[model samples]
Target chain A: MMQEPQQAREAFRGGLRVPTSGCCPGWTQANLISLPREFAYDFLLFAQRNPKSCPVLDVTEPGETSASIFAGDLRTDLPAYTVYDHGEPIGQRTDVTDLWRDDLVSFLIGCSFTFEAALLDAAVPVRHLETGSNVPMFRTDRECRPAGGLAGPMVVSMRPIPAERVADAVRVTSRYPAVHGAPVHIGAPESLGITDLRSPDFGDPVRVEHGEVPIFWACGVTPQAAVMRSRPPFAIAHSPGHMAITDARDSDFLVP
Target chain B: MMQEPQQAREAFRGGLRVPTSGCCPGWTQANLISLPREFAYDFLLFAQRNPKSCPVLDVTEPGETSASIFAGDLRTDLPAYTVYDHGEPIGQRTDVTDLWRDDLVSFLIGCSFTFEAALLDAAVPVRHLETGSNVPMFRTDRECRPAGGLAGPMVVSMRPIPAERVADAVRVTSRYPAVHGAPVHIGAPESLGITDLRSPDFGDPVRVEHGEVPIFWACGVTPQAAVMRSRPPFAIAHSPGHMAITDARDSDFLVP
Candidate 1:
């Protein structure tokens, strides 16, 4: 039932601060955002324009608490939830059971973790999992198209792929367009405006061996950056690493 | 080069009344909605949920005038315009050159005429086009989930598919997701809540042969119906027959 995260979120609602990954297997997860209805068009437009970084999965009808088109229950599906108001974290809730509103619309975006499983399946080393650290993600100078007030630079997650398996990395991951698709930048960190592999704007750093080079894929965090820049009167997003679990599988998103 | 609609809109703005379709081919076109930002989330969720009816090709950032994303000068993109305020058509304008607003968000939706062209390429006969009449459409009993406050039934366009060639008919049309990919209700009209094929809620009726079955596909009119049911304070949709032609080629939307 993928109940660990659900239980954790239940506890988180009571108060828990922890990243939830590998906690739910086979249950597809999502990046969460709840904002006033006024921002829906711009946010959806922004996500459409910048799909690699923000592949929208399902958008809940405004005022509708449950994602009727996607699944039956969103409140109990995720392990926990984080609330943001006026562009700042208010607090974490296991269930948004209390904060639900009729004027708010929720957006579920595809996450990079979907493809990470594919990488591991293809025999690609996911150092973050092996070393117990989050995948290194860097902020790039590449400017995403500014939609309305939502505007910001792109953010990318990096994984060190062995030189010999680099082509395999692209071939394997390209099959999954719903989860960031293929690499936006590979081999050179500086090309993507990254100065060093040791330091990442978000997430913990992982090792890059002499034979391995950093490969970057667009991250779900990009639109969150845009939301932050716009500083809407109210906005919400998933906590850095916590995500909403869903029923979708890796094969569901494969482009081919 | 695409100045006919511009001239027509100019005439309408200067004061003219006429329908717009085939006025300009090599031009980008769209359904115009000028609503308060509050309805943004529901409308977006509605469109996302009902893509075949509201297959969004482009959505402008919030509180903006021209559809900078897909349409450059919506001022003269089409030959005529309909301004609706609270589910009622206000007046006809050739060019909404003066009606632009920062609070208005424009959306470009895929028109089925594109698929008719594709069908023509495959030698499929388009009955409505042959008879110089609109394709027959009916209101189905199936209800679309209310996004925000927008809620209504699904509307479908019906075509008489020769029983022998139903497979070919499905194959030829299913490729274009942009133009309402595939038929939703293949044979039975009653099953879709449509009782009669000779009379339709919208569009002109056509004859069905002895061996032909009435096939139903989701119609673009579904959005207009949803808009009408919701009765937003203000909205603008493409006039029933007039469609916005896009820069995209039909082949691009063809599914393998």
Candidate 2:
């Protein structure tokens, strides 16, 4: 009796409050962003300019509930939503029905979850998935290409891949440009201004064995950082790790 | 001693008015779109939803003439621009200096010129380039996914590739997703509602040899068609085959 939309509805109604990382094996997951109609253009332009950091998966018309890839309403479908006001986290709630407005626009962005499945299938180790912890992320010295009023330093997520298999990792991930694509930096933490891999800005660090190297990819958290820095009047995003599950298959994002 | 910007400046000043197909080797070429600030969000959303047909390369801030990729002013840099009013072409001019406004936003989209070079470099024959004619284009029965206020049938350009070399052609073009990446259809023209290979809705039809299969790619003209169909009060686009050249190389758009 639990069909796709029904399952999502269950999550919307508070029957499911867990992180969506491995919840649905083959479905695509998306990072969420919501803002007033006045600021949607600037936010979208920022994503267009810095595509690697903010690879937009789908966008909704102002005040519209559903998106191109998902059937459920945007306001309450996700398990949790974080509201931000003037760059400060106001609160987290199971539903935003009270906050929904006629002038709000929603944006769904590609998440690393889509490519992690590809990496796992290729036998490339996803350290965080194996350890049951979040992927380690860092704030880098590199500045994302700015657009409109949004501007900030690029943030990246790191995974340890065997040195010999690094080429294979690049090849496999390159096929999925929708999901942050390939590694931005390979084997050099110093280049990205991350001096100590043990101390990350976000998430827990994983082990890097003798034959492995740290590979960094542009993270979806980037737009969040930009929103925090720019401090628009109001904004909303899915709580990290609790993403919006879409009907699109993982293979749909791949290129030749 | 002429540099990259100098070439486009000369074109802006009326020294170059020909089709930009083979103008500067190795550089990137882009489709151009300009509109009032209010419609910018909708057009960008349309491009995002129907990426294959409208692969956005770069977008400019409102009232800004230069974009991230191009160094010259968009108002007069391109050799020719077409002005549209209520979905009808009103005039074609060498420059739109007199029509410049403080609220117009310019968009630079990826053109097929980038991938055509890759195809030729791989020794794949381009019939249009060889025969001195425009690539054959058609308006298909296929409808692009609607976004905001823009909606239209997807337009595609056809190239007859030798049956044996079809895979090679696909491999070469698939690397350039920034441009229209791979063929959306192959072999059967009827599948796309085209009854005659000898006739096309736009551009001249090229000869299809006995062993060649007609491969179709999503065309840059699609956004133009969508804009016209949407009937925005005002719009500006580059004249067909007259593109905005950029400093970025074609290889810059290629994935691993």
Candidate 3:
């Protein structure tokens, strides 16, 4: 069924723009990006330098409607998206709605599913889904490339894998670098320069087994790291845990 | 030299900050992080989630004077640094003498040298030094994990490496996870959703040889990506070419 972005957005109403991650269970979820025209070139350049932290999905031409590669319309595809002005949350509505601009650019990026399946295939249990808790994250001593008016830190999402499975975990996850492949830091938050595990930087804490080591992956939060410090004038994003589900699947991004 | 941060800053005032890379040589060349207290937690959390983009060097205790890691002091240390408030450049001062705040928190994190040396050891040539230009960067269709109230796209830096050296580059670099390790994306800008390579998103463009595939690494600029989009009320950082050099060395962080 080829439904228009606006029509798809309208169908969900207040319920639409919600994360489309689960809409198509087997499909991948992507991050959404909306930016002004002035910083477009620089921002695009920045993303290229920092792929793991900023996996590029689909981009739209300035003031254009459709995506660079993926299908669906930029203005109406997602059921929900947020709007920002001068780095402040001005509103949240399904679709870009009245906020679309000639200078605005849209981007979609791959999520963690590509590697998760690999982990699952390797029989490495992802603790969060088992316990139904959010993965624990910590700020480490890592940095990302800076460009234009963009700069800040790198973010990561950690999964607690069993001690015996750490090697397999790394092997499996390394296959998909597009959606954050491999662990940035293996164990000991302090080694990554993290002090506490109970208090996570983002998301809820997941249970770490007694012998398990915390395996961290570059998360989709690198952009958020910049906003908290620099506070760009305008930005919009999907709500936490809420993501855009793409027509693509995890198997599409495997390196092997 | 066991000099204080402020004292080290004084050295830069005497034309010492020039060619600042590896200035303290072995010291940690940190990407300065200064943000208003209102956004402190979110940013601290943002750094936690996107450690690669915003690593936690040493965050100044709120209203307290001094950093906990990397540098001995926040008043000064690096050869040079910059400050930004509300998405505008107020000034680039050798010392943050006039703008020091009780609420401001300073953060220092690991830099790429920890991994760059690995690349060099593996015989990977870094071109920016030869070309005397900034490493080219671009935006990617990627999203970092969101923390606090911050979120946006990912930014990255690029280097052209011979295709044969790719495996070595990944292997050598992967040993140092503290700094950005491993190539995020290897070749084909469009594959990562990047449309251009000559016109970078951040730094100056470097040369790409006939057989050299563009080898990209996670950059320190990812945080700037979020900062620009979120536009926190107040923030400070090392100017594009400037960094806070700490008491660190590239060899100290390698995995055996």
Candidate 4:
């Protein structure tokens, strides 16, 4: 069995530079967002206001690459990094050691992977995971509360749950509030301004079989969407589906 | 019955300068902290790390007094304000409008009052509340995980719960993680370095009856303790027990 910290250490040594999905079972996986010191507070406040979309797991002080909560190095532990310049992707690299700066701050945000684990444990079928494709993500018409220079539409990931099991899906996911808990929308995609479920703005669309209702949960990609719209001078984020596996158990975040 | 926002507006009009306990029956109350732009990031990081002590409810951008989640003018809506200089409280004020600066960032943190309500609802007796005295707060040997320039001993408030009902108290309070959540210490104050159950570092002490266990929870005063220890050039906070009444319901913060 692969140990959690060992996996991160392997990634740090450049041996594991692939997506972190399915690594460190029962622990949380987090999305990474890095920005300059000047924009750090704004992004933090944005996450606070839009908690459903951006549940912050941990934050690093400016010039600090170590995450105290997750207990890992930000610069090298993750398998991949994507750097953006003025809202546009400049490049992707295996390690961000060359781009590290004293003015930079990083955030570890909760990913939907934890909730998917809960759904599966509760016997709620997760379509994308079953089909071996990326979960479909869409930009919603709902406007997120703006914070300083960051603002955009709420982004959601959809899963088609059997109509009889939607309540179970909601109940199981609601226990993990730190990982984008509960369904934000159910049974209606057009209300969120999604024109077609077959063609999503991100990820692959899965089958919405008969007797199933499409349920959407707030997505961690919401921050990336906000950053792309706001276009700070410099920013770094984990590539899509590449997350930082944390040592914290999914049960650790569950509320009574 | 006085409405929640109306009560806050009364304080804004300079007519209500009393503790906010029992003022808004169902709404959440928040502790206020205002710091300069330079120290804002550090305090935010500090709160993010010690969540049980400082669960952030809302944060304002630099120079902004309005909180979107809690909703109010940070300058005058609170019943009282305390100004600290280099970690020393020099004065108390009804309004900080004249002292407001372009670089100040305000943070609203979760108050223990929310979870106390939960305890009461669960048929658990809150000793201090029953005695109509301020909750007994003590500084512990436990060091908060330091963030940037902020670090200090974790401060906790003690409650005397009957041994038979301690589990019920924990189960009820754990539902509100935005508040202090569950007890950090139970039955033994000595383990937390408290020698006298009748003496506390802050607030009034209450009696521990026979068959009752002294339960401890991380307190909001923890940030004040850290701020005092750090000694920043300037800081502003709500006077203890005088909180900002929020529009959010205590139920809104409850988890499954």
- The CA lDDT at B216 in model 1 is 83
Model 4, span B1-256: residue lDDT tens: 3566756656554747766655677788888899998998788888888999999988877889787765677888887888989999878887888899889988888888777777777889988777777778899999999988999989898999999999998888888889888888897899999999888987788999999999998888888888889999899998777778888899989888
Better of 1 and 2 by DockQ: 2
Give the docking tier of candidate 3: incorrect
The two-chain DockQ for each candidate, comma-separated, is 0.23, 0.68, 0.03, 0.73
Arrange candidates, best TM-score first.
4, 2, 1, 3
Ranked by DockQ, the better of candidates 2 and 4 is: 4
Per DockQ, what order, best first? 4, 2, 1, 3
TM-score of each: 0.76, 0.92, 0.49, 0.92
**Reproduced native contacts, each prediction:** 0.27, 0.60, 0.00, 0.80
List ranges where model 4 is wrong by over 4 Å.
A1-5, A8-19, A62-66, A69-79, B1-3, B8-17, B63-66, B69-73, B94-98
lDDT of 1 by residue, A93-133 (tens): 65676677777878888887777777878899878878766
C-alpha root-mean-square deviation, candidate 4: 2.5
Per-residue lDDT tens digits of candidate 3, residues A1-256? Answer: 2133334344554454343322444456666777775565455545655767777665655676655334555566666666666656666666665777787766576666446656776789987657655556556677777755777677777888889999998888776666777777788778777777777886677767798888888777566565544567776665444456565667665554
Give the alpha carbon lDDT tens digit for every residue of B68-164 in model 3: 4453445554555566666666666666656677777565655664465456656788777566565677878888877656886766778788888
Candidate 4 lDDT by residue in tens digits, A1-256: 3457656656555746655545566888888899998998788878888899999998877778777556767777777778989989888777888888898988889888777777877888988878767778899999999988899889998999999999999899888889899889998899999989998876788899999999998988888888889999999888766677777788878876
Ranking by lDDT: 4, 2, 1, 3
**Local accuracy of candidate 2 as per-residue lDDT tens digits, A101-215:** 8888988988887788788888888888878777788889999887777888888988999998899999998888898998889988998889999987866878988999999
